[model samples]
Target: MKNPFRLPRRASLSRPWRWLVPLLLVLLFLAVLIWLPWQARQMEANERQEQLIADTLWVEQTLRFELARSEEALAVLGADLVSKPPTPEQLQARLNQMFKNGHELRRVLWLGADGAVLAHHGLELPPAGLAKVGRETLEMARLTRAGRYTEPYGASAHAPGMVDYYLPLFKRGEYAGSLVASYSLKVLLDETVPWWFAQDNDLALLDRDDHPIAERADGGPGRGIYTHRRALDLPGSSIVLATDSVKGTPRLLPNLLVGSVIVLALGLLLSLMTLWRHISRTLAAEAALRQQMAFRTAMENSLLTGLRARDLEGRVTYVNKAFCQMVGLSAEELVGKKPPMPYWAPEAMKDYEERFAGVLAGTITPQFETVFQRSDGVRVPVLVFEAPLVDSRGRQTGWMSSILDITDRKRA
Candidate 1:
């Protein structure tokens, strides 16, 4: 029997809104958890590439500025030699001072208009007048009336690798002589690129044909992943400044945070699983309860005995199919009707009231006979067995009466 005293539990499994909404939320949260870090990693890779490009450009500019400074000094020295001839001692002093400031220069030669060396300053001077490159650039400068660089030459017994800057000297617009400053490409990279920068990148000098003349890889050879190139932009021949970073892709947003997010997502999934399991059990139990209620209703409806139930205050509460037929009223009309019930015979109203008062006072007669008036006003005799109604909690909350029609026995 249904427990009249028990309140209904609203959390029926049939209503899916509660767990369904949370499940969708958890799935959406997991998708973002996956996408955010990958996006962060892509952004970090782009930033690292941009930084490499910017740094390569700066190094290129720095190298060119240093080279320009040396060329300007050589041009001034050539002009001064034409205007005021310095003694050997004074000329050596000036060269020492210039070399102290700039270390890229390996040799400096002052020549007369006749191509005879007037003065020379360096660690090693070539036995021959000049290499083919130096001769060509010297002639090129004499014609152009401007300073220029020689095509790069590799290491000989005298130097690591070299290029020569030729500054043409003139007096009264006459070709007087030439000033040549030889540059060591290796020394240029060493002096121009800082230690900190070299520690992370490998620097190389490439000729017009992309042939590498000299390189510095203080950290290590590059992986060729992140690289940048800038032209040296010099005269006589073009040289490209290529930077290959030793560093690979930058790390994504930290491992700890990413791991934490993964762990939390797993935890949430676990929690959802547990919640789903509990809800499943609740649904199964509710399903079983509903099936039992259905079976009980079927069994009660099949009985020949009419069943009636009332609350503690003597108010009618439940009437099965048999009870409705016996009282000659529909269950809906008889279920909530109080004493002075429509089914009570008019002549037996006094007895019905006394018995209802006894039921409310916790005193019920076990067996009794009564007359009930049918809906057509025909009187019928019936036997009734009354007992205290106990709920599922085992507490008596009302009275239950079973009625059996005795008209056939009376006729026999």
Candidate 2:
């Protein structure tokens, strides 16, 4: 007969799909790991660009403010000269005071209405290059009759980067002389750009032609530099203030940290995947074992043979439903009962006890005939088969008995 106790075969795991899932997960994790650091660097570069632009604007505003202050000072002096023309002694004294206070101004001049130098300060002899101005620039000042700044130019043989500030003086509605102030580009940058600002970056004041008038000696922008430029709004001038980060845009340590975090996350994900695989296999095995146990239980319940088990000391440990029916008792009443069991006939109690004692001593019988009294006091002849109940370690821990009632066969 086919063994009905055999369990159904468990479904096999899909090995390719099983490994492919984690493989795809690993690939995704690696993609994110690769992308994170690049993203961080790009963001850092953008932030650096923004910061450079802001610094350029700040430098532009600072230069504008300083130039305005200097222009106002020249306006005051021009007012004094127009209201009452001073003596040569008074002019020299006032100019000396102004030069002492304003270090950015390299020279000062009083220009006649025809652009001829009337008086000058700061240099014993003015360079030949400083004698004339562009007629168009001079005419603009004369027409505006207001303070204006000239485009940056080589002011003297000694100073290549100087600009002239002009304040046209008008006395009684007639054009008078003009008060001119020459500003040194180097001196202006020194007074305008902060010490801290120049430490981390290279700053430069560029003329209209993009020629650097004054520059800080922080190394030029190499690879990965962020640069920004803003115009310094001065009258009749197109001066640009520019800044650049000398050490490049993205910082190294932060990018390294971001990469480290991504690596750790990938490692953690791999660990979780490993743990999940182990758990999945374990659950599959448990399900298979449970199914096997359920099949065995169903086969045992359907058996016609009576099954009984006794521990090493001859105490009944287990009895199946068929055994209870054969003894005319419930399993609860028969299981855990000792030798001289309730179903043993009163006259055969001594014989049954001796047989049970031999069974506890490891004696086994393949088959024997016995008589058991039912609950109604009727005697039933039964054929019994006995065997050792061995555990997984091959140790005999108990006895198992199979019994078949044969009253009808005996009568026939």
**Residue 262 Cα positional deviation in candidate 1, in Å, after optimal superposition:** 3.7
Model 2 ranges with Cα > 4 A deviation: 1-47, 123-133, 155-160, 219-224, 251-261, 287-305, 309-379, 383-390, 393-398, 404-412
Give me the candidate number with maximum lDDT: 1
Residue-wise C-alpha lDDT for candidate 1, range 1-412, written one tens digit per residue: 3334323666676467876888899989998888788888888878878988999889889988998998888878887899998899999999998898899887899989999989989956657768887888889999999988887877444545677888999999999999989887888999999998898898898877777778889999987878888988888868888988887765654689797987899899999899889888987877778778777888888998998888898888888888777767887787677778888898999999898888867897899999999998989899999988887899998888899999999999
Instruction: Looking at model 2, report the run of 10 residues with the lowest lDDT sum.
Output: 1-10
- Candidates in order have lDDT scores of 0.85, 0.77
**Candidate 2: pairs in clash:** none
Alpha-carbon deviation at 172 in model 2, angstroms: 1.8
- For each of the candidates, the C-alpha root-mean-square deviation to the true structure, in angstroms, is 4.8, 5.7
lDDT over C-alpha atoms for residue 175 of model 1: 98
